[model samples]
Target chain A: MGDYVFNQRHLLGLADYSAADIRHVLEQTRTFREILERPVPKVPTLRDKTIVNLFYENSTRTRISFELAQRRMGADVVNFSAATSSTKKGESLKDTIRNIGSMKIDMVVVRHESPGAAHFLTKCVPAAIINAGDGAHEHPTQALLDMYSLLVHFGRIEGLRVSIIGDITHSRVVRSNIIGLTKLGAKVTVCGPKTMMPPFVEELGVRVTYDLDEALRDCDAAMALRIQMERQDGALFPSLREYHERFGIRMRHLEQYPDFVILHPGPINRGVELQSEVADHPRALILDQVTNGLAVRMAVLYLLSGGSRV
Target chain B: MPSRLLHADDFDRTIRRFAQQFTEPYDDLSPLAIIGMQTRGVYIAKRIRDRIREFRGVEVPLGVLDITFYRDDFRSLDKVPTAKITEIPFDLDGLDIILVDDVLYTGRTVRAAMEALMSFGRPHRLRFCCMVDRGHRELPISADFVGITVPTYTTERVQVRLAELDGEDGVVVTEGA
Candidate 1:
């Protein structure tokens, strides 16, 4: 009875995915993960396909993970960054993408500063569009990999207590994680400073709290999001040290909450979002998240390429 | 029209014969390993493995291969294929591998399996074994050890039902699209 079917093309956000759809993607990720342990991890599944990585914003992990996944699947990849491209010559997003589309691409993995930019591209080109991150709206691939890490650790996501810590207001990660985890029947609680917390995030079916201790109290898993120092220049918190003292997951928190494990969508501010020691602890899945990100991104590209349309 | 070619009794006798034929050339089966293609070939491989152990008192390492990623006509398929795990616990270096499958038809699956096997390591030699050698050869490949050969139209299907998967063991022919 493992007849799970996932027919979605573009991975815009978790808000568009159902529980079954999420499960199917996770299941496929497990298969893809096994390939990484092989001598020849590369597969020729996407040999005939060409993909374009169009990044309007800067990134390290997500971009690299997507590129590695695409290349490993034997796909022809073209990398484009808006900072060094025709965008500097005052070219609009529509004009730029349409021009790239003229080169005949099968898919586009995009990260944009404005929300709905990925959704807007779906109407512009025939190629499938995947949202690497779209402003503060959603970073779906991050959330999927986060869920995959949790699944690898706890063995299941349903009925598990997950606490997401830090920068909910500016995080596309938190938005996507909240939607994805809740859809899979996990209890989600977001912990951050009052200014860092978004308005009515509880409306998205998550518990909002200012107390870090209360959030980590009974949770099975805790994901500490990166404090977006680059995104918020208006001083949302008093200082990095004070924020760490108040909300950062330190070594003490790891010892105190022995049951709950740790995760971080990384480039961790060593002493800010999470303590340096806690990030290296055995309970921390920060590194596993990176490896799983490659697998999850591969699964997303494989599924969205409409291989099932065969 | 659907017709039965062989029943469960025939399957038992054919598998035992294959085990007997396996030991005719080699005194020691240590250099040999069995690899079954995914789906039905796995069950056939297991049955042959059991018979070999009973006949020769030597156990060979068995591995399963899924060739979905190595398939040439992935774009022409009706659905995207999910790849299964290729778990070959032992090293393939300097070993004679016996690749098993339920049917030998267009020989495309054999080609894919051979390509998929190379990723592991270089084998000393590789041999093909199939339960049925159905007519229609699209590739220059043939089985070294065949249970039976049945010539049929290109539109006909050869259905090899194993007890492990289909609740019975039999070879049947049916009309197909």
Candidate 2:
């Protein structure tokens, strides 16, 4: 297994990848993680390739992380924002991508409001497509990075209990994590308010619960997802204060579960999803998630570009 | 058909000779370190280090480097180059680094190794050591400590099998069409 190559061409979701394929990516990510610690922190592996960051939705961490990873690998990057692009003039998705496709782009990192927006690009363009976040469908890179951070902290993921708490109904992170963690032999539990919890979450091979305390009771790590206020149309919970009082991860929870670590997928609500003190605690892996996200994205882009070219 | 160039005994003698060459130049082996390229080079480096410790009464730091990320031909490859552990535990600021590899062909691996080493820190000096220097120079790079220099066609294959990895210690050349 010295030359374990990632066989997938596109990273649309974690469901498309096998357990060995996911492990291969996580193992390769260790190299990129070390590269970031080097004196130069750059490589020319992707110098000849040109990648386009096509964002049809608003984002901060994922966008910057992908761009940094691309630049660090010495790839030429083109940024496409939906608000400023031809999509604003009512141009269709296929037509806009086809226009950009003429420029000979090698890959496209896309985040759109509609689910399966990334999968749509593969049929229209020859470039490999990486789904940053497509509505509430799946964010493979974020989940992969989350798993990477978990592996880094605990040294293994198999047979570990993980609790994912927050807006499960509208969280792409939870969906991807459940699929990825389960494939790697992890037992996952999803905890959120009944309104926020998806109807068919148990079908994805994770235990569902409405109580945050029960979720974090016997787990190795707890991932607190952002509430995603923008994605929620009607109020999932009654109020932000009530939600914080009910399900927010506070310092007491840390004291209660001393053996478990905390994780959040960025833009943490100060008092809603996580207490300010808990977010700044030593056990919190939010910052590490950001760092690992870059490495994971770099690994994904490198593997996808190297994917079985005929 | 493949023809054997060096059997197990010959391989041991060549490694001991390389260890002697490494120790003869320096008054003190304190500043010297050995960095082995991924798989085969790692075992050869370990043998040389063991020999130096047994005869010269000095221990040298050994580091492992995987140059998959630093390769120049990533786009041209049929599959993604896999990576191994690159662990340089000691500081590389002023160490005299000797890069060890099993075979030297186009010298592209050496080029990538040199670049990869510089990323850690500025070493005092860097040199290359290889068991087999098969002549095909795509880059202007050559091994300083060579076991055997063989003149061969670009289509030929030079195989180095170590007992640690391949269950045998031998060097063989196979004809290619």
lDDT of each: 0.90, 0.91
Error at A279, model 1, angstroms: 0.7
Give Cα distance to truth, residue A28, candidate 1, Å: 1.4
Q: What lDDT is obtained when candidate 1 is compared to the true structure?
A: 0.90
What TM-score should be assigned to candidate 1? 0.95
Off by over 4 Å in 2: A1-5, A307-310
Per-chain TM-score of candidate 2, chain B: 0.96
- DockQ for each candidate? 0.52, 0.63
Candidate maximizing lDDT: 2
Off by over 4 Å in 1: A1-4, A307-310
Error of 2 at A241 (Å): 1.1
Q: How many steric clashes between backbone atoms does each model show?
A: 2, 0
Each candidate's TM vs. the true structure? 0.95, 0.96
